[model samples]
Target: MNRRCITGTLGPGLLVLSLASGAVVRAEPVFSPAATDSCVSAAYASSPGLSGHGVLDCIGRAAAACMMTPDGDTTVGMMVCLDGELGYWNARLTAAFAERLADAEAQDAELRTLGSAAASIEESLRAMQQAWLSFRDASCLYEQAQWMGGTGGGPATLACHLHETARQALKLEGWWAQ
Candidate 1:
């Protein structure tokens, strides 16, 4: 894996997310039109009938691809390549998006279940978000600890984390649109 590519791509994403979450407490980062344009282009480029769900799927696939490591031989490499740490990220995001979409589409009798379902789904999403936040912070800390004396591993780790984070953010954006 090219460490520089990972660092460059991931740093901005982390910074953007931090700014969006108010975690930065200072200057807010602006998302360029290119970001939305790429998402829109990807959403409609292949399938015209694509809905918000389709966009979510695209985002998930993209996230999975970014999370994958080229080497899967060693333990750490295997974990990264398998994205074992990201399973919860994928599950929670998928469930949250699915429940929201379903609630939006529900009508009448089915609508009765909407409130309860949405509540449950919202709770799950919230918990998932919290867990993901913890994971992100811990991962960053671990990377820093490992690379405190050098710059070798920090960039790669940060890049991987950022890629997954951005992937999730893109999926969430699509869900919000719906």
Candidate 2:
């Protein structure tokens, strides 16, 4: 097998383009779910193409998976599938936080506590992450309720979750400078 990585700039910002098939597919930042071509991240166990796999790819797949459910397919089943993908992204976010925290601690000899005053950076990060989860849940609940009595409620809630989780994951990746 032959594998190669191609790196370039997309409109001045860094971009990683995947192998082609008549279209240019670029991986988006974490939490975005690349909105380009099909064949999302192979991590989703869905797309056969591993071209632009990333956090963004995972989320994109969640969106597609839910939206592409067959005509007779249940929305609840789609939501369940998306929830599993969200779980994977949450784990990635946690890993990013841990990696960044370790790097920060290693740079300062006196910073053995991982943070200064009040609480450890780890605790702070965990708290902030918890807050994000709470907010995502509450907001999605509202989205669903707003669409109650309509066919859009379930999808509205699922989309809210997928987008929020992906957005947070993107933030965590930014923190991981490495």
Candidate 3:
């Protein structure tokens, strides 16, 4: 067939066929393990160090998996980031509490009671973190309604809320530490 005849004959029908194929093309993976490892290592290397703990490894793996998922869904990515941050924080707090508990053995009975109280505080802090995450997601949805023109406000607002939530959670963590 001539070029124009072939092109004209195959145009709309071909488009319909392609649309009906029920196939979805996916983008490339957004996260790399080497990159994640380097980033996490540099991020936590100095302050509030991990000290060869397996929990840090778990957090890193979860983060990398979340980032690498092929869905390209920003909400899922945000949720993953929040989860990874909480996991890391929880692990760190638990490790710190364990260290303190180990050192408190030689103290008086009141000091032992204080150690138990500290454990309860840690549990409370974790629960508060979870509640803050729920609130953050809901508030972000409410705030982004004003800027819903696909101007990237939804993800930005969500990220901002996550930062604020993390800040508040960390503050609570500081209290728990004492």
Candidate 4:
């Protein structure tokens, strides 16, 4: 049995959660985990056929590719790969928000409350997205600081950004689903 805790490319993610290791170690420091963002929105933006889970699976192939590639072996390279994937998801989110706004303008003209135009919902979404952007940035900054100046800080910080952005993308996808 290969006693080496960190072996060859098991999959996309840094830490392999599988038959090899019964427990996914919390501090194992994944080198090349699965890509966080689902590349689905690029194709099915603002559509209801796909769910958040679908998005997660949609990127599975790319994640596996990343695992095989040289970049998957290093923390820095993995960060770059994740950042690239995040871009795709972010684009989908933007498209989703725009699609929602367009729908609102065309049919749902009812006021949100009493005299407040339903357009306020658009404003609310815009505000919420901006706030989330700020929060993700700030929180990652804190995470980097906490993980020390460098050793693990860069990877952790990038991972935080990737995870949070992907999460937000999923939320936007959920909105798109609606």
Candidate 5:
């Protein structure tokens, strides 16, 4: 088996590759933020109650589609595609957090009426969200560090951000729903 990697500047921040079969493959611009958002939204809309796999499965669909495009195969293109998904997840996370926080506050108030001595749900949620932010930042930085200053670092970090944000969004949504 023979494998070869072709490197040439098609444009700024673009990378091209060639196969061992003398076939050349180029990346095109296929990443669309609207498309990504639509895919994510559809995933959520179609998901059966409490089933998260549907949304999770949609995470990299747009990025994979982008990578297959003629102008979107480069590292920078991948980062941009990942960022689009990250933006979607970040929005979801924000909405979910707000809803969850409100629910927690209500639940805490109910507990107070019952004269229960349990910890405040709203306060606990705030603390947990703060801790999760630190964890997500540290974990993503660690993922980038694994690339050791290589061009892959940027995409890896963005992917990490996407994953963490999506997970947090789902977690918050679940908490609110339950």
Candidate 6:
């Protein structure tokens, strides 16, 4: 077991790693999902019919708030905050994907019933989603690579993940609407 202490703005984030299984555990501060969700909700409320990248304005509010905290001021803390936001976006992405897939399947069924030989929308959606995932991973990896193994790489990668996830989530969420 190896333990490393990364200092934050107000305190320290303890990072623990186990050599045998290649597992890592970290005690770091995470942003509040309620706060982030509230911010996003407010953005939508303020801008009636808000969709697409317009929702991005609310993306970093909670992370910025978390970053202001004593436990979130350090690199590890920032990563945790970014991870929290990424998780939020991931949830949204999952829901949006499910909704879109279901809609596509329904549409395909309708087209089949009508004897219209249209292409499979569900298959196209699945392919696009897979490609997006690959693109997001590769793009984030490139962003991290730009840091050259520096400590900044971790946060950069996380930020990239957050950005990509949020973008995809919003895009998928508004797909049928647009």
Highest lDDT: give the candidate number. 6
**Candidate 5 residues 77-116, lDDT tens each?**
7777787778878888999999989999999999999999
- For residue 44, give model 6's deviation from the true position in Å: 1.8
Against the true structure, what is each candidate's TM-score? 0.36, 0.51, 0.36, 0.57, 0.72, 0.80
* Global lDDT scores for all candidate models: 0.47, 0.57, 0.47, 0.59, 0.79, 0.81
lDDT of 2 by residue, 1-178 (tens): 5655565657632344545433354433222223322333334344234222353544546445544544213454445545555665667667877876776555443466556444455566668878988999999999999986677787678777867876676566662223
lDDT of 6 by residue, 1-178 (tens): 7655442243355555444545556567757877678877877777666543456777767777888776687787898898888888999999999999999999999999999988999999999999999999999999999999999999899999998898888888773255
lDDT of 4 by residue, 1-178 (tens): 7544543444453444344546452222223333333345443564456543555545434444564576464665555555555565567677777876676554445564356644466666678988999999999999999977866787677667766776676676563355
- Candidate 4 residues lying further than 4 Å off, grouped into runs, are 1-64, 104-119, 175-178
How far residue 7's Cα lies from its native spot in candidate 4, in Å, is 28
What's the lDDT for residue 51 in model 4?
47
Better of 3 and 5 by lDDT: 5
What alpha-carbon RMSD in Å does predicted model 6 have with respect to the real structure? 6.7
The candidate that achieves the highest TM-score relative to the unseen native structure = 6
lDDT of 1 by residue, 1-178 (tens): 3222111123321322233223332121222223333664677676554344455443334333433423333333333433433453455456656765565455333645555443444455567777877887787677767866564464446445644664565556353344
Better of 4 and 6 by lDDT: 6
Residue 158 alpha-carbon offset, candidate 6, angstroms: 0.6
Worst 10 residues of 3 by lDDT: 6-15
* lDDT, residue 151, model 2: 72
